[model samples]
Target: MSDIATAAGGFRYRLWRGLDPLPSGLPTGFAALDALLPSAGWPAGSVIEVITPAWGIGELRLFLPLMQRLSQQDQYAVWIAPPYTPYAPALTQAGVSVAGVVIVQPPQPQQTLWSMERLLRTGACGLAMAWPRQPTPRTTRRLQLAAQSGHSLGVLFRRQHAGPCRHTLPVALSLRLDAAENGLAIEVLKARGGGQLPAVTLVWP
Candidate 1:
């Protein structure tokens, strides 16, 4: 299927499908979630949309292991305008380097997106994340393409629907997260190969 995202300039795109086998990824620590992900870990050099109701809904927990691993490997992990202050003790306990983390809070939303795109495009950060209100198809495409141009993983955490749009996001992975009894429930709305995948319910590591 094909779609068009209209902005000042329109972006036309098709569903993502890679002919090569999915690449290996950093382990998610949550075995169940890793098993369902395109790679054994999160997809590298791609934008992953994570939709959640709130900050503490196991979102950070879901990616902590990956972040820590990247930091240990000397890659910077960045958070652009995160919803809440990251507790240093908690992150340290998780084995993440506090020094390797960069938090940028742009005074304006437009600057925030711009900063995110630049960081992801440069691939200087191992991961770059942002929490923003709904973005236009054009904006999402820009960030998605920027991530593809670099090796960093770009993540957007939203509070709205994560379904397919008429002007679909060029994201390689999309997930909807909700608090579950044991931990969190993740619905894989899209994966590397471009299709609806299964839901993964797991406990916090």
Candidate 2:
């Protein structure tokens, strides 16, 4: 039966059998940031870490547009251990479909990662966001494999003490947020692509 499906339409049809088509790379609402990212967009089938010392550092700001874009395309977005209750008004204003948002709260850090991995591997979700205290190497490896297998986007929100991950995969970026006179200052501490490394100051209007 499976062979017949593949023979009829090739691997593309087989890969998407019984599932919605996978989303393309993230659509950065901001053109400049989009260009900086490899593939000119967020990496699919990979784990991306968003680290911050505290909440309200505009970390959500960086993620909101991406989430909104994904939801706009009728894809689902999952949030694990979100710091606060998301304001529905704000999300709606940003063009995200509040209906498609799924929030999962896991009691333990390990459980959070486990849930995220499971969801990402299900191929039923387009994106999964988790705030894990300190992820272990074993957990990260598992999550990495799940993301690749499902071709899902995983964003791991880490605290300051999460420390340096020793994973073999190279760190794509390390961003630190600070308060600037204008607004929030985002410093690209480390990135794979070389450049002047400008600090982006974003003032929410």
Candidate 3:
């Protein structure tokens, strides 16, 4: 069940099975950033944390490539509790399969986490993304375990806060995104088998 991704000029990337030490991951649609990751892309079956100072800073753009690939797959790409309604036309223009994209908004914040865990643990979805407010370490750990169980990718987007402590979270990867002069700057805060690396700048996807 290898997930295959083909890039421009016939380049291909292969996703490996989930393992304890991590394995080759799915392409993130950006070659420069992929070169910086140990798995060469987003680690499959693991949770990733994206921390930003504010919204609309190209945070969603970073995952657009990955979303496009996952959405078109046999499984669904579920988005839980998005900040705003996703614009279909814009997503279509980005090469995403609208039919494969599903949105779920829970009335209560706690329910959002529960929904994300269920979807990720079902093995029926390729990816599950959420924007949870005040996620405790226990909550993240649960999400991580669920992703591992289903071999799905889980993304948690959080706003930058004062005195932020990323060490408390059990996510497999933690990245800090900031707006660069020409494009977006992705700083690798924490990664499996690696420490903080230099930021990689690339045009918005």
**Local accuracy of candidate 3 as per-residue lDDT tens digits, 44-152:** 9889999999988888888888888876775788999999998999999998888889999999988999999999999888889899987888988999999999999
Most accurate candidate by TM-score: 3
Clashing pairs in 2: none
Model 2 earns a TM-score of 0.74
Instruction: List runs of model 2 lying over 4 Å from the truth.
Output: 1-24, 162-173, 189-199, 202-205
Which candidate do you rate higher for lDDT, 2 or 3?
A: 3
Sort the candidates on TM-score, descending order: 3, 1, 2
Give the poorly placed runs of model 1, Cα more than 4 Å off.
Answer: 1-24, 161-168
lDDT of each: 0.78, 0.70, 0.84
Reference-based TM-score of each model: 0.83, 0.74, 0.86
Instruction: Write the residue-wise lDDT of candidate 1 on 1-205 in tens digits.
Output: 3222223222212213445555446677787886667575688877888878777778888888888888889989989988788888999998999998999988877787788899998857889998865566788888878887887888888875445553456677888889999699889888875355679788764
Least lDDT summed over 10 consecutive residues: which range in candidate 2?
Answer: 10-19
List CA RMSD, all candidates. 8.7, 10.2, 6.4
Give the TM-score comparing model 3 with the true structure, all chains together: 0.86
